[model samples]
Target: MARNILPLHKRDKTDTPSTRNASTIVPSEQAPSPSHEPKHHHQPHRPRHENALHSYVNNFWRNEIVAAAAEFAGTFMFLFFAFGGTQVANTAALFSDRATAGQENSGLTQAPNTSVLLYISLIFGFSLMVNVWVFFRVSGGLFNPAVTLGLLLIGAIKPIRACFCFFSQMFAGMAAAGIVSAILPGPLNVSTNLGTGVTPTMGVFLEMFLTSLLVFTIFMLAAEKHKATFLAPIGIGLALFVAEMVGVFFTGGSLNPARSFGPCVVTRNFPGYHYVYWFGPLMGTLLAFGMYRIVKIVEYQTVNPGQDFDDHEAAAFKPPKDAETAEQVGRPNVAALAVEEAVEEAVRIVSRGSREERDEEERIDGRLERGEQPRYVSERELLGRTGHGRV
Candidate 1:
C-alpha cells in the first residue's frame, strides 16, 4: 500500500502543537458557530494576484517550508553545542596541564577523569534535551539521523521528509564542525573517534549498543501515542547520558551518525572502519524496532488473550468521544477522521461484492446506462429465502 504523505499540519493527530491558534486566528466560513462567522462577509472578492499570493504564503507556512526550516534550525543549534562543548572541554584540559603536550594535553586525554567525563556527557545530553523541546512542535525534534531512520522504517515519518531531515542534520553537523574548527586553534584535537587502544570492532559494538538504547528509549517515550509527551525529551536525554557514560571511552559514545560524520568532514579523519558509525547506529535502530514489536506483541497478548493480531482492525482506530470533539473544536487541519471514514465506506461497498457479485453490479450499471431506474435487490430476494417477518 502506498503510504499517505500528508503535510505535518494535516498528518499529526497528537495533542502537541495544537493547531487551535492557527484555526482560531483565521476562522473559516466552514466554522459552524455564528460567533465564528467572519466580520467582512460582504467585502468584495480579493484580486486574483492577491488570492494567489495569500495561498502561496499559507501553503508554504503550513506545509513544506516551516517544518524543514525548524529541522534545519534545530539541527544547527544541537550541533553548535555538541561541537562547541567538546572543543571547550578539550581546550580547558589542555591548559589545565602545562607539562602535557599534543593529544594528552586536552581534556579528551586517555585518563577519563570523572569531572571531564561528566561535563561533556551532561553538556551533550542537556543540549539535546533543550533542542528537542524547542523544536518538538515544529519538526518532531528529531535531530539525529538514527532516530529519523527508525521513524521511517516504522512508518512514523514519510520517506521524503525523513530524507530532508537527514540532510538537515548532516548539513548542520558539517556547518558546526567548520565553525568550531575556525574558532578553535588548529592544533587542538576535537575529533569524535574512539579513544586510544580501542579496536574498530569494539568501537562498532559499543556504538551499536548505545544507539540501540537511545533509539529504544525514544520509541518507548516519544513515539508511543499513549505516553506523556512533555517528558519525552527528558527521557531521551537521560538515555543519551547513560549511553555516553558507558560508551564514551570505547567509541566516543557517538550514537548519532551525523555527529560522528561532522567532525570527520571537517578534519578529513576517516578511519579504515569509519563506516561503522553509519552501520552500527542504523543496525541498532532496526533492532530497536524489533524490540518494540516484541513489546507490542506481549502487550497485545496480555490485553487481548487468545485473539490473533488484526492489522486492519488495529489500523482502523477510533478515538474516544471526547477526543473526537476536542479535535473538531481545536484542530481544524485534522482530516484523518473524514479520510478514514471515506476509506471505510469504500472498503465496505467493495467487500460486499465478489466475482459473481461483480457480474450483478455490471448488470446494474448497464441498466443505469440505459437510463432505467435501478431497483434495489434485498438479501432475501438474492438468497431466495424468506425474511424473518415473512417466514
Candidate 2:
C-alpha cells in the first residue's frame, strides 16, 4: 500500500522495480469483462414462445373437454323439444278424453289418447334426427348415455371422454327438464312409470329389448364406419322412434337414463322402480355389443351383406377405386407397419455395413458386380478331366 502512494524516489527498498511488479494487476487477476457483470434488467417470468395462460387453457380444454361441451349443448337441445312436446301431448290428451254421461251423473275415467302418443314419438324422433345430424361430427351427437357406453365398449371413444360425456348428458337432461317445467303449464308426465297391469319384471325386460334395438343400430351404422356412416343418424333416430313408440306406453319408453333422469329431476319424482331406466339400458348396451361381435366374427357382410354395391370408401353405393391400396385407406395394419420398420432397419444396417453388403442389394438383371465371382463355379469348369485328355 505504501508503494502505491509513495513517490518512486521515496519508496522503501522492498518496493523496488522487481518487487513493485507484484503491486500491479496481472492479466489473470483483471476485473471481469462487461458481459460477466450482474444484469439489472428484469427477466420474463414465463417463456417467450409459449404463454403460460395459453398453455393452461389448451390443457384445460382438451379433446375430452371439447367433446363434453358439444355433448352438453346437443343433449340440452334434444331434450328441450322432447320435454316440451311431452307437456303438449299431456295437454292434448285432456281434450281427447271422452266421458260417458252416466245415468246417475257418476265420475268416469278416460283412457289415454293414442294420437297423442304418436305425436310424442314424432317429437322425440325428429328432435334426435335433426340434432344428431347437426352435432354428430362434433361429438357424435350421443345425447343418450347408453349410446356413449356402447361406443366405449366398441372402442370408438376413450374412457375419459366417455366419462365426460356421461356427466354432460346427465346435467343437460336435468337442465332441459327444468326449463320445460318453468315455461310449460302442466304437471310433468315425462317420468317413466309401469303401465297398468305391467309388472316391474315385464317393464325391465321390455326396456332392455327396446334399448338394445337402439344401441344395435348405432353399432352397425356408426361404429362400423362404412360408406353408409353419413346416413347413420336417420337409422338411429328411427330406432329411437319405434323404441319410444312401444316403450312410451309401457315404461315411458326411456331407452336412455338421461331421458328418464331429466323428468324425474324436474317433477321431483322417483318411482320405486327408477332402477329400471339405468339397469335396463346398461344390459341392452351389453346385449347389442355381444350381437355386433357375433356378426363381426361370422363376417356377416361376406355372407348376406345385402347389395354388394361394394361402395366407395366415402359415399354409399359409389364404386370403389381400382387401386391396390384402396382396402387400406382407413384401416391401419400393424403387420404392414412392422414390415415398414423392418425395411427401414435393413436400409440403416446396409448403409453402415461394409462395401460388400451394399453390392448385395436386389438388382434388376440378377447379375453380380464386374470383378466378383461365384465361390464355386462347377459347370464353368467343364469337368477338367476331359480337358486334360483323360476321357
Compare the candidates by TM-score and give the number of the best one: 2
What is the Cα-based lDDT of residue 107 in candidate 2? Answer: 11
Tens digit of lDDT per residue, candidate 1, span 97-154? 6344225422243345666667778878988999998898888999899999998877
Which parts of model 2 have CA positions greater than 4 angstroms off? 1-54, 59-61, 98-112, 305-391
lDDT of 2 by residue, 1-391 (tens): 3345554332233546765575455564574565765555444498468545565567645667789999999999999998788767766665455342111111111135567678888889989999999999999999999999999998998898899999999999999988887887755556677766778888888989999999999898888777589999999899989988887777778889998888787777777888998999998998999999888776665433324234332232222343223332343444666789799999987777844433333231133334334333442242242241122
How accurate locally, in lDDT, is each candidate? 0.71, 0.74
Query: How well does candidate 1 score on lDDT at residue 375?
Result: 58
The true-versus-predicted C-alpha distance at residue 28 of model 1, in Å, is 42
TM-score of each: 0.61, 0.63
Off by over 4 Å in 1: 1-62, 98-110, 185-188, 300-391
